[model samples]
Target chain A: MTGSASGLESPAEDLLKVQDLLVHFPVKVPLIQRLISREKVVVHAVDGVSFSLKRGEILGLVGESGCGKTTVGRTIVRLLEPTSGRIIFEGRDISHLSQSKLRPLRRRMQIIFQDPHASLNPAMTIGRAIGHPLQIHGIVRDAEEVRQSVLDIMREVGLTPEDQLFDKYPGDLSGGQKQRAVIARAMILEPRLLVVDEGVAMLDMSVRAKVLELILNLKRRHGLTYLFITHDLATAKFLCDRIAIMYLGRVVELGPAASIYAEPKHPYTQALLQVIPTPDPDKRRKKILPRGEVPDAIHPPAGCRFHPRCQSVLPTCGWEGRDFIDLLDEHLSTSPKGVEDDELLGSIGEWWAEGFEAGRKTDAKDPKKLVERVKEILAKAPPAMAQAVQSVEAKGEFVIVQFRTPDKLVHTAVADRTVECLLYQ
Target chain B: MKAKHSDPKRASSLPEIPLPFLGRLIHPLIRERRSLAGALSWMGLGILFFFIFIAVFAPLLVPFSQTQPFASPVLQAPSLQHLMGTDNVGRDVLSRVIWGARTSLEIMAIGVLIALAVGFPVGLLSGYVGGKIDRLLVLIMDSIYAFPGLLLAALIAAVIGRGVFNIGIAITVIYIPLYFRVTRSQTLSVREEPYVEAARALGAKSHTVMFSYIAHSAIIAIPVIFSLSSADAILTAAGLSYLGLGLEVDTPGDWGRDLSDAQSFIGVGIWWMSVFPGLMIVILTVGLSFLGEGLNDIINPILRKERS
Candidate 1:
């Protein structure tokens, strides 16, 4: 399967390179500027995401919903423009190319959509729709050649009795037939790169496996580069050689599919593995129950993004100033907003002072030194708008923030397999 | 992707039924009492076709020279000498009616045809290439749709000063927006379809995708709209004659003018004067409406899928 990658990674034969890509969608309210100005909150849908495909590597991006897996796939193909990123395809900077400039490139990259029924035009006969690409790319001159090419591709996709189906409209085909017609259309141009966005997600379970096999077969037959995006890791394991696990708009785990699945590094990956239903219940194992719903993208948790849900959270997890405020906000069960109602803000200030005082006790050996540190923190006035300070220090050792942020992505850690969790540290 | 070896026999048996899908697609027309409306349509159209055939060959069919005036009795009423009862001018009433069919259908078909030719392309372009082009076409068409179709046609006739072509060109101007609007909407939805995207991926130019993929969906709706528009055109032509803006008042030979003048005689209880022309309008409109419905029934998506 990876023999195709040799052509892709070779500088002369490279197909596409995606580097540190970020696609932030600014949630806009129609006709209301004052209501939400630099109030312009950005959903880090795909943040600092980086990956590259050698000529034929099948890179599977696996994640749950809102993981930005789909965004990465689309941005790399230039289907959707990246907010800030570089998409180098065969040595050309295609990231911001205009529609006209992108025309020729489109002939080399194709996408097979999820909804088979919605993909093919109901008014067009299979032959016209399939032959459409051949004529558009100017690959075929004669009308007869175009028809013959469509028939050949239709057969390749396992559409048996292709001649009989030629004159039929998409509305006539069943789910499987429609999907095959779509592949027939895609393969007509023999694109170098194919983005299959959960391409088989919509099919019945029985149909899903067969479709996946067809894609595998096509890869061998055509030497195609596939960026298979799916929330199903199991499918990724089945189809991809190397899999990247995405979380909160970033890749937190990636490595060889066989290696990662057997020795999963990311706690999120482990939790996901446990959830896959086993047909044989007798073989079921204890599932890891990660806490909390996925946080709002607009204002994510400060430390590790997964801190709130990670069972093994470290206090040192990306706990910066934002993490402090988030914990105070969590404690009050209220957000601090008004300067006039400075009471909540004051309490948040005191909370931080108390947190520092506790840290002093743990670091200091002498009781007198600990007391001096607490006095110093209390003596200083709280910052403006940050009015008062809350004090609840027992033995005075640690401040408890609500959650922790996982420090690194999956591949960055040098474990035998790429896993994204503090436990590896 | 292959069907199972023992896939339910009931699913396979579905082809025997007329495909329940056909019923769903045509269900709206049935509910609209369109199927019944079709009866009035076909019966009327058959008469119109017969009338047109006779009118085209009036001299040959009727065996009478319209200009050979007063060769027979000056006035005759329902005798072997004449079928419908002759006028004071001594012309056969049947021959005039037969001759009149030419003017009646000619104006109607020509006016509608002109509207479709211009409106279809405008609608197709406006819809597929949305944004400035679409907005501009939509605004212009909407303006025409906003104007009352009859009043607009009348104004165009008056301005042109006089001619059958003027009436047709005017009616087309007012109703092109209808075709434009329908075509644009169909294009919008069709463009979003995967097949269109597939075409784009395959490197199809904007024009190829627009015409090859999007325009065909809009074609289905044209028959229904065109038939109805022609009905309106027929009435418009008649109104122009009523206003003395059509076919010239000196030529009392036109159906609309004949109907308009007969209205003055309505007070004298001359029912035949108003009745004949009124029936002509009703017959033509019914004919077009039935044909439209029949087309809809035949091409209805449900039925189309069933046969496929």
Candidate 2:
């Protein structure tokens, strides 16, 4: 991949590379429950996310709140351990390193949190909190030296009158000043890369612009690489050299910010870009929001994670038994003759779905009528859902509805970007 | 350019005032919460310090010996010679009351400090590095907390035998669970704060994050707990001494011991004997309770704001 910005030579050497990173958090279950169903449930927070950061490059991780962008940012910095995958920093795999072993490496990378108000120790003075890292890493032993360094960073971040503000507590600072102090704290370590996890998301609009300006300025001045995690595509367009649009826990589209904005390849990216509110009052546009809430991460949809909500969904996008069940439920709820359909279909509780196959008990009902009813429901469903059905037949005492196995989805190169969509594949 | 808005004069005009150790400790609390509750807390603090000062300067404050018995003047009422009157044994009632503050202060200091020292770390560890260890600690602390405070202290005092230190231990046992529960709960919440995560991302050691970030935030509740438990400790110490599980009689002046001694004299209407000591106990306990209540009012809002 080539760098997006003009007038800057793109470096071949990667400062940070994350390969197939996966972070799954185990959900706590009662002992008896765990033992009874020996299924180890986990939240697939960041699954198989891969990216690389070039020196001085600003890579934006953009997605909705639960899209695992924050988890990916945190996992890259080793704040959250990756359940699998390699995180190579400067040609060394540092993902699995113990915290003690990661200490020295931490000085080369840092994280700026989302909330300025909550990201500072209230009891600690601004100066002490900012300088604490130097003490922790034993980078500056002398208090005076640490103070000078902290004050320098404090000034750079525009928390001015640094000497006086040094003794003031975080409680004394406004939200903007607090965010600046937090930035100064991270900048004091002189890290090569920064994972800014929605760093300016909590700031006011005017202050957000200033902070974004400061971020860009810092990048230029310090030659720093940034893994900028934000949900605002407009902010990403403003600051990012490249943007990776994540959906659920996977990167759906990743390419130059300008190109992606000009021509979004993935349907998810297109939908995301289409929703950015225009500043002009006269230019009213239709918002193409993805249907339904983000699916639960515990059991992410198979084939394509976004297919369930994709507006331009293809037949092979990924249709499974759950989708069929969802279609049946929707048809029953909205059908004009719902009472007749309910009697024909029986209670949905007796239906069972696993993988691509759904079956209903036909012992009480006529098996031929059950198959006919299932076919009628499919005929009224979304074309993609109906087109994916392989067969509907009465086998033994059950009417089994089987769906075709979708082709394996893979990230494919489209114009100026790589998108994980069947449309591109 | 943005820095120009801030007045350099105003910034420099406020001189840094180097406070004395105790003033420094209390400066933030008083500064943050300046209300009627704050004034009441100050009054409570004053009462506590008044007792402490009397305890520290007991020898100079009262002239008559606390234990020495005179032949004539037994059961004398308040007069110029011996204010607060003389006890049944003719020992100065005023002197015994003044000296009793020392014993109570000692128990308060030992009980609170030991409880804080032990409970703070245990609770911090249990909450910060949670899992089986947390469950285990919560179980243990809850078990200890389930027993009635005075009953547990009395039982411990009964088993350990009697002395100032033994009574202090009894008070400590009663309060450790209190501190543990408060610190543990606070730590549990503070552990989830974004600041702690920021500190960890900065590569702070587990101990540093625990003590510096988690402990510092968790410690706000401790003072409230400290004041309340100290009031409880004073009562526990007195209860132990009254039940014959504290210092031996006449070795040092003790309110509980003196009150016990004056119990029989009440039938003769020599009220001076029990009244003064009982009054001291009541006054100190009320002061601490007010201090604790006022502090809770002042700090709870701050804690809630921090959480949000």
Per-model TM-score (chain A alone): 0.77, 0.96
Candidate 2 lDDT over A29-102, as tens digits, reads: 99999989988999999989998999999999999999999999888889888999999887778898998988
Residues B80-139, candidate 1, lDDT per residue (tens digit)?
656654544555555555555667677777787877888888888887778897788778
> In order, what DockQ does each candidate have?
0.36, 0.54
- True contacts recovered per prediction: 0.73, 0.86
Question: lDDT values of the candidates?
Answer: 0.68, 0.87
- Per-residue lDDT of B144 in model 2: 89
lDDT per residue (tens digit) for residues A170-197 in model 1: 7678888888888888888888899888
lDDT of 2: 0.87
Q: Specify the poorest-scoring 10-residue window by lDDT in model 1 chain B.
A: B13-22
Residue B95 displacement (Å), model 1: 3.4
